[model samples]
Target: MAKIAVVAANGKAAKKIITEAVNRGFEVTAFGRRAENDTDAKNYIQKDIFDLTREDLKGYDAVVDAFGAWTAETLPLHSKTTQHLADILSGTDVRLLVVGGAGSLYVNPEHTIQVADGENFPEAFKPLAQAMAAALSELRKRKDVKWTYISPAADFQAEGERSGKYILAGEEFTLNPAGESVISYADYAIAMVDEIESGKHIQERISVVGA
Candidate 1:
């Protein structure tokens, strides 16, 4: 069984992931600040990721972070929590899959969609956005530990179905099969879990979208 740990597993999509993972017969562990609703599996655990020590990561084959800067207001906590996760993971042989912001994904050789010069990207949100970018930057240089930073389309929100199909790529690449870009949170999770199981992508940043 694939032993996986999902940090901040109380989020909407995360609940689906845990459900699907358990149904698919994988050993799933979810750690978060608050208790999740319920699960058939006894893998749910309550703990602040920031409180996790290096030993905390010993058992999982992969760590999926659905945790994002909640409100633009929580970037400080976001940065701190994220950095702590990255730091702890960096010390181990485990894989890291933290979601990045679309703002940093490049639209052209000279510019990125997240922040354009003189353009506003959520100011309060930028800190964690920046944190994701910085984290990906550091992860890119590591030869050990598989890394995959994912971003949703511009239309990403709490909607869609678990169709189990989407796109994947690294920096400077965009996966938009519809001519325009968009993906359901469900489809994104399907792709997310698929990657966790397949181990096809290692040390890359990709965006998820539908056709």
Candidate 2:
């Protein structure tokens, strides 16, 4: 059985992914910040992903990095943790597959479709978005750990039904009209687990959207 570790498995998406992966016979260790809300996974390890050591990160075939938040202040959480994980998992064969923000996805004319409306979207949101972009900049500098950064749908969130259908693209990516790339937390989990099993798209960024 493949051993998998889901860092920051606290969200609906992470919970659903761990659940589905466990049902598929994968030995999953769902790690989260708090132990109180850990009934989501079959077996949960309560720990902060940022402080995870090599010993803690070892023995896992791959890591699904669902450790990020969408806010005006804690925008750099994902990338900072990514830096930490990169250090821990470096010089080893452990792979890091992360759930990234869609702000970095390509828009027309090579611009990213950031959450920028000047006023409606808080100034706070831009920094975190830019921080994630900076985090990706750092990720590209590494040649050690096999990294695959996956972006969420434009409408990827707590809402929406589990259609189990979405589109996957590499590098430059985006959504269509009426949020064509929307995928529920369940389907996003499914896609992440699927990617982990296949071990494809190493050291690259991919985006997903619903049909």
Candidate 3:
């Protein structure tokens, strides 16, 4: 079984990933600022993400950076936290799988426009989106660490249905058969765990949407 560590494990999306991972029999350890006794992961580590060292994550097969910050003042933490993790895992074998934002995914085949650049993109979310895009941009510049950024659908629903099906795509944004870019937290968790076990997209950014 894969020994996985999920940062920001107490969050809505991360919690669903933890549940799916645990159900799949992975040895999952939840890492966060606050320890939740009710968390579904097999183990828990209470610590600030910035304070985590290489030693703290030495044996894990993969580290999922499910860290998120939505407020205007805290948005920059996206890039900072990602850089911190990359710095600590520079020369190691552990995979850094980031739960990224869809805004960074290109909306055109020419690689010119991103979802964040679309006219319909929400104004309130631009800061958060830009911050995540920065994190991904920075991650792309690193060659020492093995990384994969998984961006959820443009419409990432916290309480949406889990149909046990999804469509995974590359850096360009894609819509499902229904012509909608959406995915539920539960189904997205399935894709995350599948990627962890398969290691299919190292050093790449992939997107997932409902089938």
Candidate 4:
């Protein structure tokens, strides 16, 4: 079984990922500032993201970075934490899977502009989105680290049923038949663990949309 460590495990997305991974029989360790009130994983570690050392992450097969920040002031933590992980996992076999935002996804075929740069993008969420974009950029430059950044659909729903169905795409934004860019957190978690097991999109940015 793959030994997986999920950072920021208390978050909604992380919780779903943890549940899905546990259900799939993967050995999971939950890492966060506090223990999850309800978690299936038997192992739990409470520590600040930056405080995690290479030794602390040594044996994990893969690390799922589910860390997120909502405010502009704390947005820089996204890139900072990503860089720290990259540095620590540089020569190790441990793969890093980042739960990214949709902001960096391309808005057009040319891929000249990102969804975060589009006019309709919400202003309030721009800082957080930009932070995730920066994290992706940082990951892309880490040649020594195995990393995969998975961006969710444009409309990422926090509450929805897990359909066990989704469409995986490259850097460009993906839309469903009805022209909607959306995916529930539950399904997104399923997609994430699937990618972790497959290792199909390593060292790249991929997106998940509703099927």
The CA lDDT of each predicted structure is 0.70, 0.77, 0.93, 0.91
Off by over 4 Å in 2: 70-73, 109-124, 176-179
Candidate 4 residue 142 C-alpha distance from true site, Å: 0.5
| TM-score of each candidate structure, all chains considered together | 0.82, 0.86, 0.98, 0.97
Model 3, span 97-170: residue lDDT tens: 99999999997789989999989999999988899999999999999999999999999999998899999899
Candidate topping lDDT: 3
Clashes of 3: 0
Ten contiguous residues minimizing lDDT sum, candidate 4: 34-43
Candidate 1 has what TM-score?
0.82
Q: Which model is ahead, 3 or 4, in terms of TM-score? A: 3
Candidate 3: where is the Cα deviation over 4 Å? Answer: none
Model 4 over residues 65-129: C-alpha lDDT tens digits? 99988876788999999899889899999999999999999988998899999888889988888
Q: What are the clash counts of all predictions, listed in order?
A: 1, 2, 0, 0
Clashing pairs in 4: none
Better of 2 and 4 by lDDT: 4
Query: What does the lDDT read for residue 206 in candidate 3?
Result: 92
lDDT of 2 by residue, 77-102 (tens): 76788989988989788889887776
